[model samples]
Target: MLSALRKYLILPKLIRLSWSAPKNRTVAWDRYWAGIARTGARSDVLWDSGTDHELLAYRDVLRRHFDPSLPIVDVGCGHGAFSRALTAYSPRVLGVDVSPHAVARASGESAGVEGVSYLARDMTGPGAGAGLVGSTDANVFVRGVLHVLDAANQAALMENLRQLVGARGTVFLAETNFQGNPVEYVSHLGASLRSIPAPLELAIRKLPMPGHFGPEELARAMPKDRWTLVEDGAATIETNPLMDAAGNSRVPGYFAVLKAKDPDAGR
Candidate 1:
């Protein structure tokens, strides 16, 4: 009753105010993660499926592509889920997020995990990847991140990724490709107008609305002149289990493997 009221009536207004405010996406994300880390558990996050099935699947896809000797960086890694998973593929892993609370939580959860660390860095900000610029080219893993940003921020993030990966490393990105409006997307995921799920509600009330990302969006962000597409195909992003569904909820998604073209080659 009250939950339904908040989702449909109350939260819509609040989310609108948040959209209109001068807050950047990083601040919104910081507040969202901080709120969850303070009051909720991992199971409360919708996209966190509480299982490693998706990670395992991606591992298979990346096994042939990633160099085990190179370090891996997980961007937008909430609570270090993928960061911990990347250890199987690399000797060193660094998980970076915009929220300090998220970094703290990831670091706490990753206690005793060798060669794994967490840092709070907003990838869209000016000179965001400066601290991470190193001689060794790092393989990058990003999931469900680019679509949330507007065009400019997406470009900024790509620039940061360029710096992080340098010329020799590979980059893999997976993103949700829901081709509908917010209400339609939620409804397709088994939510009704009056009976929105709690995780979905939390996302609605706090986080930025997620946009779709497919091959076209990827091409725009990673131009052909600067990047070489290695492989890409259809994929699925798993979400938390839904009550009426047979298993965890699944969303349509895509993945791409790319390498930065050598600058000297074009010149």
Candidate 2:
């Protein structure tokens, strides 16, 4: 009875408070993630049960597209889940993130895991791409990070990836779409709602959320002069039985594969 009351009644109030909350997104995310680090929790623990599907989808993409012999760089890799996963195939995988706590936790968790390492570095900073510059065979993988950045930061990130991957390298990006239908929105929200207690979820939701972009907007955001889109399509992160207007299943996220137009142009 109390659970029902909190879910139906108290939840609405908390959601409202979350909308009105005044918090800097970067600071809030750092602090929130710091708490996760201290607890030594796996990043997936924050998501609903179905997040495993998304992880599987990512693994599938990697298997089909990623070259095992080439170095792999995972940008904005929180807690190094995918980075650690890549160690099975690649001899060199570097996961970089802006959060020191996240990097430290990831490094500690994956310590002695051959072929994988974690670094605390902001992709947007000057010379941040220096280490990976001119690696024509490298691949840069970014997921669940771009939508959170502003335009300038996003551009900087792309530039960094371009440098890391070089002219012939490839880039894979996965991001949530803000223009999803009501069902899609609910599906995305349900992940958090199911995993977190009602009141706490509500409080967390009130904090500043990340930005979302439609497919066209994402295409426009890419640096056309440097990268050429190879493939892009709707991706289902969670199974939804419902169909959209086009009779296709609704998905909460999307993915893109881009190749450098000129691998040796800016070097």
lDDT of 1 by residue, 1-267 (tens): 675443344445445534643256777777777777432233667788777788888877788788778889998988787788788898899999988988988898889888899889988887676666366778899998898887788878877777767766788998998877665566656665456567766776677778888899988888887788999988888876642243437888999998877633322
* Model 1 TM: 0.87
Give RMSD to native, each candidate.
Answer: 4.5, 6.4
Off by over 4 Å in 1: 1-23, 37-42, 243-248, 263-267
* Number of clashing pairs per prediction, in order: 0, 2
Clashing residue pairs in candidate 1 are none
Winning candidate number (lDDT)? 1
1-267 in candidate 2: lDDT tens per residue? 674334343345445546754476555555555666222222222322212456577776667777777888889887777777767657888899887877887798787889888888888876587765233468888877787787778877777676777754678888767575332343334422334333234325533555675467565667678778877877654322221223232346788888877756544
Q: TM-score each candidate.
A: 0.87, 0.74
